[model samples]
Target: MYRAPRGTSDILPREQAYWRYIEQKVVNACQLYGYERIDAPAFEDTKLFSRSVGEDTDIVEKQMYTFEDRGGNKITLRPEGTAPVCRAYLEHGLHNLPQPVKLYYIASIFRYERPQAGRYRQHYQFGFEAIGDDDPALDAEVIDMAWQFFQSLNLRHLSLQLNSIGCKKCRPGYLAILKDYYASHTRDLCSDCKTRLKRNPLRLLDCKKPQCQQIANSAPRSIDYLCPQCDEHFNRVKRYLELLDLPFAVNHRLVRGLDYYTRTVFEIQPEVEGAQTTLGGGGRYDDLIEELGGKPTPALGFAAGIERIILNLKKQNVPIPPLPRPQVFIAHIGDKARDEAIKLAAALRKNGIGVIEAIGNKSLKAQLRQANTLGAHHTVIIGEQEVKTGTVILRDMTTAQQRTIPIVQLQEELR
Candidate 1:
């Protein structure tokens, strides 16, 4: 038997409660924020990601699942959400409709990586994007939405780590200073950080290795080197966040993994000691639209791993509302009763009642046991006598008390 590929697992029936819960919360949150839903293809041209997410980023350089299609075109499974949303925004002329197009998506993201707890090769993500505007207030709204989303989940002890990585203009200067500082620590740098120093210096601060983190800690802070415009933008974003009373801290080493990020970058993570799990994060990507051949458009977005959220929910012992299941089961004792049970099942379903009819000739006792196991609220028994009399026996699964009722009254009795 073939198993699911490495780094992937089946989301079994018993696991759906968590998924449904998170999905409902996601939909409700988006609706409250006026974010309409948008979905993009599972895969896109390989160049789309390389262009928008940056050539040197791990997503493009290492993790992306790129392959040639039948047409011999290079295609890549989407490794992230924001680029695809931006692509759709540009392709569909959404920019023509309004100044800011607020959109949300729940999509499966694929990457070739070593899977760990709560991380998978093909995992689902819930993300929302606000494209076509650059107001600091909008940034705050996006961050606030992210923070409040976790709050709505009732996940406790989450910290919002905020930072400004400066825009393209001032970032180069910061990178120069950063590279100069790391120049002396070349021997102490990790092999990856050594390469990052050459290709993507900002990612050095994002390094997790102990020694690299120490080097990043003492490195030049990006916010300190922001240009005048970026400085003002950072300040206003803070003021707006403060106005909303969001608890946030300025983390100097909080540069996000994406190259498109600029100015305000932030992440929300659980506050457990020695644990660095980020529930979600996003920041301003002011240059990405123009980079993708569209006119200059400032956009920002936040994405959280559904698996990670479910993991955290389980960790916190949060309660999840179970998905609705069949509440009534119909059991039969004979062929005539089986036919009647089928008809009754259909009638109940048509009347908007959920009923599970017995299948494949089970004993009445066995059928009732199945109903009890399924947590059915009531079981309707249609034996030969009941079918002849046009009546049914309804048993309360919880109380074990049963009564004979006319077939027409079954719906009302179940209700």
Candidate 2:
């Protein structure tokens, strides 16, 4: 039998409750924050990512699913969320509307990577972007939204890791210092870190290997090298976060894994011991729009993995509200009853009532058994006598107490 491809899994009915719960929370949070929703296509010109995410980044070099289309254009499945949003902002002329346009998206992100617990090659991400502005207050609001989103889900013990990676003006000098520090410990670095040191030195600080992390712990801090403008910006971000009563820590090694980021970068991580993985993160990509061939536009965003969030929710045993199901199941006793069942089902649905009509021929016992399995609150039984009488046997599945009611009263009874 054919099966789902590796690194991907089917999200069956049993798993939809978690997805629906997370999606509702996302929608509610975005509505409260006044962020409009925008959805970009699943694929885009390959250069869009190669330029905005940095050609040397792992997403471009090894993870992106790139291919030549029938028309001979290089197309790549979206590997990350922010770049596409930025592309949309530029393509659709969102800058003309206002100085700051806030938007959010819940989209499928594709990547090629080793699958592990809570990690998949294709996953859903919830991200929001505030573009066309660079105010520190906006940064606080974005970070606040990220923190409050997780808190809204009843997640506990999360840490806000904050850092300023300086801007284009001061990052060059910081990279020089970082490369100098890493050059001396070349032998101790992993093969990946060794390549990172030569190509993208900032990524070295993001390495997770124990030995590389130890070396990074003592290496140069980017905040120390921030230019005067960036320094002031960082100070104001912290001040605004403090005013908002947000708990954040300044981590020296908190550089994010994107090339477009500058000035402020942060992450939200669960504080669980031995599993302190990041749930989602985004930062100021002040130059991304300019890199994408538009005028310079300052933007900041935050994204969280849906699968990871659900995993943590399960791990913490957080309660999830179950998805709404049909309130009434229609089980018929005979062929004429089944025909009546169809007409009644249509009438009930047209009246805004949820109904699950039984199909095929089955004994009343078997039909009721199916109704019980579906968790339906009430079952409406129709047989030859009921059809002839224009009535239905409404059975309360929970109490096992039923009553004979006219067919016209079924809708009111449900309400």
Candidate 3:
């Protein structure tokens, strides 16, 4: 009578093959890019997010899943991956290892926002981050990685959008322009956008509210106001992208929601997701390391929601992988045969052969039926008659043709 907890989903067995397929591609791609995998806890000190993600953002202000532990310590289920990864980088002293600490993560992140199709409170994210070194090539490399990651997944029609919001140099002035620009239309903007106008005017441009989006249509663009250094850096990033033969577009209004991002922000949006949705986005957050109590460093990275990617895949009618069929099924009769089947199962497992059997299957006919239902490629029958002879019968479930073979030769014979 009970249902799943709100805002959660079960990755059921019938659909797990596709999940594994996507995950395997990610793991392989990460290795190809020289990114070592690191896992941070699902939950962390609540203050980590409050400080790192900014207290004023919706993630901390309205969407975090914070709770008090029995010890009265406040902890929160991580709403995003970067903060936890940064915490681990600092705590474990990864900075001393090398110039750029390259890392990738595939994990579930929690947020307490409204759930909708392709959007969930609990969902998976595939993230990559590169810390250290401020070279423009690094920015291009991060953007390239995002592009290649999606391309490898066969996701098409995604446009890479890039921008630089300037460092401390001219950032405040741009914010002021944005504030001044929005102040005039404050009465026409959404209430949330109006409130954001007073707090972080830059956020008003990011608002998804209908009227806010309409109001921001003519807002001052950030790239036009970038200081000389920021302009040069952004140009260099674009130059590198061209060198790599990658295509991209400049979107000056591309301000990522997080406060840590300082320069060179970008997103990979599916052309089909339209106004209300995007695949994923991230940008340079050079000051994050300094705030995390590490030496000042320029960093840039991006993350994509795995669920949204899968959703798009489904929408495109891309094939979901078929469930794996057992390569061999062991059917046994009597105690001796059962014992032999158990030994055979272990040996097959050691050799990386997938086998399935009900250890307690009481009848030969029943076992065969179960084996056929499981779509096993072959059925290996061990009965008292065959056990005494030190041989087993291998039956092709599909063809109904079988041959008996010595138990010791079973592995090779099947192969």
TM-scores, all candidates, are 0.97, 0.96, 0.92
Ranking 1 against 2 by lDDT, winner: 2
- The per-residue C-alpha lDDT of model 2 at residue 375 equals 95
Report the alpha-carbon TM-score of model 3 versus the true structure.
0.92
After TM-score superposition, the amount by which residue 136's alpha carbon in candidate 3 deviates from its true location, in angstroms, is 1.2
Q: Write the per-residue lDDT of candidate 1 for residues 360-389, one digit (tens) a residue.
A: 878888998899899999999999999889
Candidate 1 vs candidate 2, TM-score winner: 1
Candidate 3 or 1, higher lDDT: 1
| Per-residue C-alpha lDDT of model 3 across residues 1-415, encoded as one tens digit per residue | 9877788899998768768767877788788788889999999999999998998888899999999999999999999989888888888888898868889898899998788887788999988889887888889888888888788878778888888889988899999988988888878888888788888777777777778887777888888898998889989999999998888998766788888888899998888844436788888888898887888877877888888888777777777668666699999999989999999999998998999975675688999999988899899999999989999999998999999999998899778
Question: What TM-score quantifies how close candidate 1 is to the native fold?
Answer: 0.97
Candidate 2 Cα errors over 4 Å, as ranges:
273-276
Cα distance off (Å), candidate 3, residue 362: 5.1
- Residue 43, candidate 3: Cα error in Å is 2.2
Tens digit per residue, CA lDDT, model 2, 15-133? 89999999999999999998999999999999999998889888898999899999999999999999999889888999998879999999999899888876788989999999999
Candidate 1 local Cα displacement, residue 203, angstroms? 2.0
